[model samples]
Target chain A: MLLEINDIHVHYGKIAALKGISLEVDEGEIVTLIGANGAGKTTTLKTISGLRPLSAGRITFDGKDISRLAGHKRVLAGIGQSPEGRGIFPGMSVADNLHMGAYARKGDLSKELAEVYELFPRLAERKGQAGGTMSGGEQQMLAIGRALMAKPKVLLLDEPSMGLAPMLVQQIFSIIEKINERGTTVLLVEQNAQQALQIAHRAYVIETGRIVKSAAAVDLLDDPEVRAAYLGGDLGEPESIAADEPAATADGPAKD
Target chain B: MKTNESTRERTNGSPTVTNGRPSFAALTPRARDLAGRLPAALRAPGLPLAFPFAVLGLVADLFRDWWGRQTGYVRWAIYGLLIVGALLLPSEQVGGFMSPYSDWAQLLFFPIGGYILLAIGLNVVVGQAGLLDLGYVAFFAIGGYTMAVFGTKFGWSFWEILVLGVLLSALSGVILGAPTLRLRGDYLAIVTLGFGEIIRIAARNTDYIGGPNGISGIPHPPTLSEWTVPESEPFTTLGLAGIAPLKYGALDGRPYYYLMLAAIVVTIIFVKRLESSRVGRAWASIREDEDAAELMGVPTFKFKLAAFAIGAAIGGAAGVIYGSQATSIIPRNYEFIISATILAAVVLGGSGNLPGVMLGAFLVAWIPERIRGLQEYRILVFGGVLVLLMIFRPEGLLPSRRRKAELAEGTGGMGSLGAEVGGPTTHAAAEVGK
Candidate 1:
C-alpha cells in the first residue's frame, strides 16, 4: 500500500471521532470514503494531512511512518488537501492564491502554473481577480488547482462538490479523474456517494466515524446492502457497471 | 381580544407622554448631516497645516516614484539634501520661532523620531504579521533599559551600546513571543499587554536598572563633523550652505536627527524587502487563516516569532537613540499609552503597507506638537480625530489594498472542526500550529 492507516483513533476533547479506523490507498488508485455528515470523512482526511494527530494509530505514507509529522510537512511529503467549503485565500489575487498553494514547492512553477491555467482556463482568464470574487464553481476550481500546484503524490479532496451545480459537479469530477490520470493517487472524501463510488477504484462506507464496508467501487455499486443504504436502492442489483462510469447505472429504483 | 387588551393594558400602566417624539435612531441621518458640517469647519483652521503637507505630499510622491524604480542615487541625493536642511536649521535658542525653522526640534523632534521608529517596528509585528500586540512598548522599554544599563553601568560608547540594546531587545522579543504567540490573537494581545505592563512595573521596582529614579547621563553617540571635516579652515572653505558641523559634547539635536533619519530610511528598505519575500507571503497566509495556511505549508509560529524578533530589534535601536539623545532613561518614559500611540500610528498610516505606516507615524507624532495650544484638550482632540478617521476609513490614510481585501474577507484564523459529522475537533494538532 502506498498510503496505509492502521487502527488510528482520534479525539476532539473527551469525545472520540475516529475509533480505531483503518484504511488503505495504493498508488494510482482513486480511493474514496463516503458517509453522511460527521461520519469522520473529513477527520480521516485531516488525520492523513496531519491536521489532526492520531491518538493511537500508525500512518505509513510511502512506507515511512508519518503520523508524527506536522501539517505543512505532510504537504511537503506529498499530501495536498482541497478542503471543504473551498478554502481559497480571499485576500489574494487568483494567481497569488495559486502561488501560495505551491509554498511547499522548491523549484520553478511557471510550468506548473501554465498546466493549472491550461486545466482551468477560467483561472488564467482572471488571474488578477481576488479569490473571494470568483463564483463557487471557479473557487472550487481554484481550490483544486491550488492543491495540484504542490505536485502531490496523493491528493486528498474533501467535499470537492459540496455546493456546486450538478453540471459543475460533473465537470469537477472529470477534472479529478484527469488529475488522477496525471499519475497522482487520490483519497477523496465525498457526500455524493453514488457519483463518488462511480469514479472510485475502491470505496469505504463510514458511519459515525467507523468503517462499515470496504469493497471495489463496482462491487459496492452492485452490492444490495450498499445499494439500500448508500446507492439509493432497496431491491435488485441487476447490472455490472464499468469502473470509470460517471453516472450510476440505472439499475432502476428498488421495488420495496 | 385578550392580546389587544393586554397591549392596551401595558400602555395604560405607563405614564402618558407629554410630547411623543421620534426616537434617536429616527433622527440619526439628520444628526449625521449636522455632524458632517462640523468637520469642514474644524478642518478650516487646519488648512494652514495643509500647505506644508501638500508640499510634503508632492515631495513624497516624487520620492515614491524614484523609490518604486529603486533609483537609489536620486533618493540618496534627496536624503542628503534633507540632512543638510535639517543640519542648517538653527535651534530655538539660536533662531527663535520666526526663522521658518521650528525650534520645536529641541523639544519634540527627538521624541518624534523615537515614536516613528516604534511605529515602524510595531508595523512588522502587528500590521504585516496580523498579530495584535498591544504591549509592544515592552520591547521599547527593554531597548531603552538595555541602553541605560549598558551606557551607565559599563560606561560603554554609544555606538557599541546600541548594538547590545538591539540584540537584547530582540532576545527579549523571542523570549516573550516564542511561548505565548501561539495563543489566539486577542489572547496574544492581552499577553503582550500584560508583558508590557510587567516590564514597566519591573523597571519601576528593580534597583539594577535604577528603580523608579532611572538611569541618567546616558552617553551621546560620538560626533563625526569635527572628526571628519574638523572645525578647521578646510571645512569652512568647503562652505556648504545651511550645513552645520556635528558636535558631540555640545548635545546638539540636529546631528542626532540626521542619524535617526538615516535609521528610519534604512528600516523602510529592510521592511519593504521582507514584505515581498516568501516569509511575507507566509505571514499573509497565516494572518488570513492559520489552518489553511498550514495545509498550504506556511509555518506560522516560526514566522510570527521572526516578526517579533525583528520588530523588537528595530524598536531597541530606536530606544538606544532615545536614550542617547535624552541622556537618561526612566521607567516612566515607557508607558501603556506609548504603545497605544504607536499602534495608532500603524492604524492611521495603513497597516501592512510601509509608506502608509510611515505617514501614520508622522501624523501621530505631529498631532501633539501641532495641537500644543490646546494643552490638556490636545489628546482628547487627537482621540476624536482617530475615531472620525476610523469611522470613515478604518484602513488608515493609505490602506494596503492587500490588507483591505483581507479585512473585507474577515480577519481569518477561524477553525471549524467537529459537528458530529465532522467530529468535535480537538484541534490539538494544527490550531497550535506546532
Candidate 2:
C-alpha cells in the first residue's frame, strides 16, 4: 500500500465529521470515494490533505507517519490537491496561478509549464488572463493544471465534475484518466458515482463519514444495494452497467 | 504561420479573449513580461547598491564644493548656474535643481521624509499584507522614545540608539501582532487602535521616560572620522588646495539634509525589494483573500506577525532619525492623529506603490508647512481634500493597475453609490453569504 488510513476520526467543534473511517490506496492506482450530499466525502479528502487534523488513528504515506505534518509540507512531500471549489488564486493571472503551485520548487519552471500546457491547451491561450474571469469548467481545468504543476506523486481531486456541463464533465474525467496513465496515482472524492466509478480502478462507498463498502469499480457498479441507495435507482431495476463495456453485457445496457 | 498571424492580430486591434471572455490587452506582451520580471530582479539587488551610491553621491558633492572654493568668481558662477537650471527645470524637479546641500531644504524635508518612510513601512503590513494595524504609530512612538531615552538620558550615540530603537519596536510589533492578528478586519483594527492609545498613555504617564514633558537634547549623530571636517579657525576662500573651510553648527541643515536624504533612499530601496520577493507575493495573496491563502499552504498567522515586526522595525529606524534630528521627543507628538496622517499619506500616494507613497508623504507633510497662514485650517482642509480625492480617484493618485482592476471588479455592480455606503453594504452581503 502507498497510503494507509487506519480508523481515523475527525471533529469540527462538537460535530464529528468523520467517525472511524479506514481505507487504503495501493501505489499507482486510481482510488475513489463516492457518496451523497453531507456524507463526509469532502471531510475525508480534507483529512488526508492535512487541512483538518484527525482526532484519532494514524495516516501513513510511503511507510512514514504524516499525521503531524502541516498541509504545505505534505504538498512538498508529494501529495497535491485540487480542492472541491476549484481554489485557483482568483486575483492572480492564470499563468501566475500556475506558478504558485510550484512555489515549493526551486528554479526553472519551463518544463512544468510545458507539461501543463500540453494537458490543457485552453490554459496556454488564456495564460495572461486572471483566474477569476474564467468559466466554471475553465477554472476547473486551471485548478487541475495548477495541482499538476506541483509534480506530486499522488494527486487528490475533489469534485472535478461539479458545476460542469456534461461534455466538459466527460473531458475532465478523460483528463483525469490521462493524468493517472502518466504515472501519478490518484485519490478522487466525488458525488457523481457513475462518472467517478467509470474511471476509478477501485472505490469505497461511504455514508456519514463511515466507509460502508469497498470493491473493484466493476463489482461496485454491479452491487444492487449500492445501486439502490447511493446510485439513485430502485431495487428491482438492473444494476447500473459500467459504461465502458459494449452493449448487451450480463448487466444489461448502460443508462443514458 | 497561423500562430505568428494570430500574434500579430493580437498586437493589432483584435480583442483578446481571456478565459472565453473579452478583455482588452492593454499592455503588450513584452511590456507585461518586463513588468513581471523587472521588479523581481531589482528588488533584491537594489538595497546593496543604495548605501554605496549614496556615499559616492556625497563624495561627488564634496568634490564639487571643493571645486567651487577655487575662486570667488567660481562660487558665484556655480550659484548662477544652479539658478538658471532651476528656472529651466519643471516645478516638480526644481527641488533637485537646488544645491544638494541646502539648509532650508533640509529643514523642510526632514520630518515629512521620515513620516514617508514610516508610512511605507506601515503599508507593508496594512496595505500589502491586509492586516488592519492602527497601532502602527505605536511602533513609531516606541522607536522615537527609545532613541530619546537612549541618546539624551543615557548619552548613547545616535547610531547605537538607532539599532536599539529598531530592536525595541520590532519586539513591540511582535507583542502586538501575536495577540491581535487572530482577530479579523474591524476587530483587529479596534484592538490595534486601543494598543496605540495605551502606548501613548504609557509614554505620558511613565516618569522614567520624562512623563508628559518627554525627553530633550538628544545628540546629533556622531560623524565618521573619514567624513568629519576639522574644527579649525575660519580661513579665507583661498585655503589649502583652494578649498574653503566647511561650516559646522548644532543645527547645520546641510549635514542633516544629506543624512535624511540618504535615509529616504535606503528606505525606498528596502521597501521595493521586499515587495518583489516570495515574501511579497505571500503578503499580496494574504491581502487579497486570507482564507484562500491559508488553504494554499501559507502559514497566515506567522506571515502576518512577520509583516508587523518588519514594518515596526522600519518605523523604528525612522523614529530614531526623527528624534536625533529634532533633538526632542514627546508623547504629544505621537498621537492617533499622527497615525491617521501616516495612513492618509499611504492612501493618497497609492498603497503598494513606492514612489507614489513618497510623493504623497511630501505633499501631506510640506503643503501645510508651506502655507503656514492656513495652519489652523490644515486638518479641516486636509480631511476635505482627502474625502474629495477618495470620491473622485478611489484608486489613489498613482494606483497600481492590478489594484485598480481589483477595485473595479470588486465593486463592478455598485457604481457611484459612494464607497462609504457601498463598501459596508457589499461587505455585509459577503459576510452573510459566508
Candidate 3:
C-alpha cells in the first residue's frame, strides 16, 4: 500500500467528522469514495492532507506515520490535494498560483510550468491572468494542473467534477485517467458515483461515518443494491444501464 | 444543534450525516508544493530600491549643509535672497516670504523627521504585514522611556542610551508580539490598544523614571574630541580660510539635524530593502491571505514577530532622538495622543509608502506646532480635518499602487490602468461565477 489510514477519527469540537474508519490505497490505482453531502468525504480528505488533525488512529504514507505532520510537510512528502472549493490563491496570477504549488520544490520551475500548460492549454493561454478570473471548468483544470506541478506521487482530487458542465466533467475524468496513466496514483472523492466508479479500479460507498460497500468499479456499477441505494436505481436492465451511462456523460446533468 | 441544522439546510438542502468513513485509499497524494526557486531578484527589478534613494537624498542634503558652511556663500546668498524678497514684497506679503525661510531648519529637522521614522515602523506591522497594531505607541513609549530612564538616572551619554533604547524597544516588541499574535484582526487590535494603555499607565505610576514628573537633566550628545583647534571660541566664528577655535555647542542644530537625517535615511533603506526581499514578499503574501500564505509553506508566526520587532526597534531609535532633542522626557510626552498622532500620519500619508508617511508625519507634527496660536482649538481642528479626509479621500494623499488596486478591486470601481488590469470580474469569477 502506498498509503494506509488505520481507523482514524477526527472531530470539530465535540462533533465527530470522521468515525473510526480504515482504508488503503496501493500504488498505481484509482480509488473513489462516494457519499452524500456531509458524509465526511471532505473531512476524510482534509485529515489525510493534515489540514485537520486526527482525533484518534493513525495515517501512514509509504510506511511512515504522518498523523502529526503539518500540511506543508505532507506536501513535501508527496501528498497533494486539490481541496474542496478549489482553493486557488485568487489574488495571484494563474502562473503565480502554479508557482506556489511548486513552492516546496527547488529547481527551474519553467519546465514544470510548461508541463502544466501542456496538460491544460487553456491555462497556458491564461498564464498571465489572475486565477480568480477564469471560468469554472478552466479554474478546475488550473487547480489540477497546479497540484500536478508539485509532481506528487499521488493526487487527492476532491469533487473535481463539482460545478462543471457534463462535457467538462468528462474532460476532467479523462484528464484524471491520463494523469493516473502517467505514473501518478489517484484517490478521488466524488458525488458522481456512477462516473467515478466507471474510471476507478476499486471503490467504497460511504454512509454516515462508515463504509457500507466496497467493490471493483464494474461490479459496483452492476450491483443492484448499490444502484437502488446510491446509484439512483437499478442497473440490471441493459437499456437502463445505457441510459445511465449517457446521462453520466451528458452536458450539465452531473453538475448538481 | 439548531445552528448546525440551519447551516446544513442552507448549504445542501438537507441535514446530512456529519461523520463518515476515514478512507486512506481515497486520499489523493498530489502535493501542492511551493517551488523554492531563486530569490525574487528577477521578479522585482530596479537597483537599490526606495531605501537607497532616501539614503542618497539624506547624504546629499547633509553634504549641502557641510558645503554651505565651508564657503559661507550659500548661507549668505539664502539670507540675501530672503532679505531681498522681503524688501521687494509688501509688508503683509513680506511675512509670507519670510515664513518659508523662517524655521525651515527646525521644520526639516525635528517633528517631521521623528514622525517619518515612527510611521515607517508602524507601516511594517499594519500595512506590509497586515497585523493592525493599534498600540504601536507602546513601542514608542518604551523606546523613549528607555532613553529617559537610563540617560537621566545613570547620566549615560546620549548616543549610548540611544542604542540601549532601540534594543529595549525591540525586546518589548517581541514580548508583546509573542502573546498577542494568536489573536486575529480586530481582537489583536484591541489587545494591543490595552497593552499600550497598560504601558502608559505603568510609566505614569512608576517612580524610577520619576513617575508623573518624568525624567529631566538629560545632557546633549558629546562632541568629537579628535578634531582639535583653538579653545573658548565658537566653531561658527572660525573662518574657512584660517584654523580657529572648535566650539562644539555652536555646531548644535546643524549636527543634530544631520544625525537625525542620517538615521531616517538608514531606516528608509532598511525598510525598502526588506520589502522587496524574500521576507518582504512573505509578509505581503501573508497580508493578502494568511491561510494561503501558511499553506504555501510560510512560517507566519516567525514573520509576524519579526515585523513587530523591527517596527519597535525603529520606534526606539526615534525615542532616542526625541529624548536627546528635548533634554527631558515625561510620561505625558509619550501619551495616547502621541500614538494617535503617529497613526494619523501613517494613515493620512498612505500606509506603506515611505515618502507618503514622511509627508504625513511632517503635516501632523508641524501643522499643530505651527498653529500654536490656536492652542487647544488645534486638536479640534485636527480631528475635524481627519474626519473630513476620511470621508473625502480615505486612501490618503498617496496610497501604494497595490493598495489602490485592492481598493479599486474591492469597491468595483475604476482606478489606474494597473488596477483596471485585474478588477472585480476576477473576484466575482472566483467566488460566485463557479
Candidate 4:
C-alpha cells in the first residue's frame, strides 16, 4: 500500500467524527470514499491530511508514519488536498492561485503551470481574471488544478463534485480519471456514489463515522444494499434501507 | 462592477464622453472620464470634497505599472529626489505651508515621522498578514524603553541601543506570537489588545524603570558635525536657506527628520522586497484563509510569526528614534490610542499599499496640528472626517488591486466591513461560507 490509515480516530471537541476508520490506497489507484452527508467522509480525508488530529490511529504515506506531521509538511511530503468547499484564494488571479499551490517548491514552476493550464484550457484563457470572479465550474477546475500544482504523489480530493452541475460533474470526474491515469494516486471523497464508484478502483462505504463496507468498485456497484442506500435504487423508500442499518456501535473502544 | 467599466474603457481605445451631465459639469472632460471610472461609493453625492484624494489614487495607479517595471537604480533615484523634497520641509518657505504649527519641522520629525514609521510596521502584521494587532504599541514601548534604559543607565551609544531595541522587540514579538497567533480574527485582536495593556501596566508598576514617573534624561544620538549651511544667494533663492547646522541638537529638528527619513526608506526597500518574494505570497495566502493556505503547503503559523517579528522590529527601531528625539520616555507616552491611531493610518491610507499608508500617517498626524484653532472640537472633526472617508471608500484611499477585489467580493480579513457596506459580493463568497 502506498498510503495506509490503520484504525484512525478523530474528534471535534467531545463528539467523535471518525471512529477507528481503516483504509488503504495503492500507488496509481483511484480510491473513493462514498457516504451520505455527515458520514465522516470529509473527516477521514481531513485526518489523513493532518488538518484534524488523529486521536488513535496511524496514517502512513509512502510507508512512512505521517500521523505526527503538520498539514503543510504533509503537502511537502507529497499529500495534496483540494479541500472541501473549493478553497481558492479569491483575491488572487487564476494564475497566481495556481502559483500558490507550488509555494513550497523552489525554482521554476512554468512546467507545472503549463500542465495545469493544459488540463483546463478554460483556466488558461481566464488566467488574468480573479478566482472569485470565475463560475462554479471554473473555480472547481482551478481548485483541482491548484492541488495538482504541488505535483503530489497522492492527491486527496474532498467532494470535487459538490456544487457542480451534472454536466460539470461528469467533466470533473473525467479529469480525476485523467489525473489518476497520469500516475498520481487519488483518494476521492464524494456524495455522488454512482459516479465516484465508476471512476474508483476500490470503494469504501462509510456511515456515521465508521467504514461499514469496503470492496472493489465493480462489486459495490452491483451490491443491493449500497445500491438502495446510495445509488438511488428504490428512491421513494429510505425507511426500508434503515431496517438493514447496523446498530449504533459508532462509539469505539476508548483508547487514546 | 468597477472591473467591467475598466475593461470597457481599455477595449474602447478612446476617452469616454459623458453627455453634458449636470453632476459632472464642474469637472473637465478628462476629469469626468476618470471620475466615471471610480467605484459607485466614491461617486456618491457629497463625496466631491474627497475627490482630489481619489484622483491622487488614480494617478498613482497609472504610475504603479511603470514603477513595477523600473530598474532598482531608477527607483532609487526617484526615492532620493523624494527624500530631498522631504528634507526641505524644515526650510522656511516649505514649512510655512502648515502655518498653524509654531515649529512645523519639529512636529514633522516627532509625531508625523514617528506615526508614519509605526503605521508601516503595523501594516506588515495587520495589512499583509491579516493579523489584527491592537497592542502594536507594546512593541513601540519595548523599543522606547530599550533606548531609555540602555542610553541613560548603561551610557550606551545611540547606535548600539537602537540595534538592541530592534532585537529585543522582535524577540518579544516571537514570545507573544508563538502561542497566540493560532487564534483567528477577533480573538487574536482581543488578545493583542490585552497584551498592549499588560505592557503599559507592567511598565507603570516596575520601580526600576521609575514606576509611573517613567524614565527621563534619555540621551540623544551623538552629533556628527556642526557644519552650518551657508546663507549664500543661490541657497536662499532655492529655498535651502536655513541657519540649522548638520548635527543632532536640541534646537534643530532637521537631523532627527533626516534620520527618520533614512529609516523609513530602508524599511520601504526591505518591505517592498519581501512583498514581492515567496514570503509575501505566503502572507497573502494565510491572510486570505489560514486553513486553505496551510493545505496549499504554506507554513502559515511560521510566516505569521515572521510577520510579527519583522513588524515589531520596525516598531522598535522607530521607538528608539522617537525616544532619542524626545530625550525621554514614559509609560504614558505609549497608549492604546497610539496603537489605534497607527491602525487608522494604515486602514485610511489603503492598508496594503505602502504610499497610501504613509499618506494616511502624514494626514493622521498633520490634520489635528493643522486644525489646532478648533481646540476641543479638533478631535471631533478628525473623527467625523475619518467616518466620512470610510463611508465613501471602505476599501481605503489607495487600496491595492487585490485588496479592492477582496473588499468588493467580501472575502479575506476585511470582508465583514465590505459586506456591511454591501459591496457586490460574488457567489464564491456565499459558496465558501457553506
Model 4 lDDT tens row, B319-341: 99998988878899998999999
In candidate 2 chain B, what residue range of length 10 has the lowest lDDT sum?
Answer: B236-245
DockQ of every candidate: 0.25, 0.15, 0.13, 0.36
User: All models: lDDT?
Assistant: 0.74, 0.70, 0.68, 0.82
Candidate 1 residue runs with Cα over 4 Å from true position: A218-256, B1-103, B227-245, B249-251, B412-434
Ranking 3 against 4 by TM-score, winner? 4
Candidate 4 chain B, run of 10 with poorest lDDT: B423-432
Question: Interface RMSDs of all predictions?
Answer: 11.6, 8.4, 10.5, 7.5
> Compared with the true structure, what per-residue lDDT tens digits does model 1 show for residues A150-228?
9999999998988889999999999999999989999999978888998999999886668988999999888866666
Docking class of 2: incorrect
Better of 1 and 3 by DockQ: 1
- In candidate 2, which residue pairs get closer than 3 Å at backbone N, Cα or C atoms, i.e. clash? none
B92-157 per-residue lDDT for model 2 (tens digits):
234443323333345344656677788788788866786767777888888888888887778898
Task: Provide the TM-score for each candidate, comma-separated.
Answer: 0.79, 0.72, 0.69, 0.88
CAPRI-style quality class for the chain A–B interface of candidate 3: incorrect
Compared with the true structure, what per-residue lDDT tens digits does model 3 show for residues A1-256?
9989999897766667678878889899999998766566777887887766788999999989999988778888888777676756554568877887777677888887887888888888877655544567987987788888788888999899989999999999999999999889999999898889999999987765677778897899888766755578855776566645523442232243
What is candidate 3's CA lDDT for residue B104? Answer: 39
- Candidate that would win on DockQ: 4
**Which candidate model has the greater lDDT, 2 or 3?**
2
| Candidates, ranked, lDDT | 4, 1, 2, 3
Calculate candidate 3's fnat.
0.11
Give the per-residue lDDT of model 1 (tens digit) for B1-434: 32432233223211111123222332333223324434666554544433333333334434444466767787789768866654544334323442233345454445566777888899888777777888888887887787778887888888898889889999999999989976755678788889999999999999877899999978777766663334455335433233343655544556676678778878878988898999888877766666678889887778889999999999889888887777877899899998998988888787877778877887787776677778799889988878766644455666654654554444332211001121113232222111
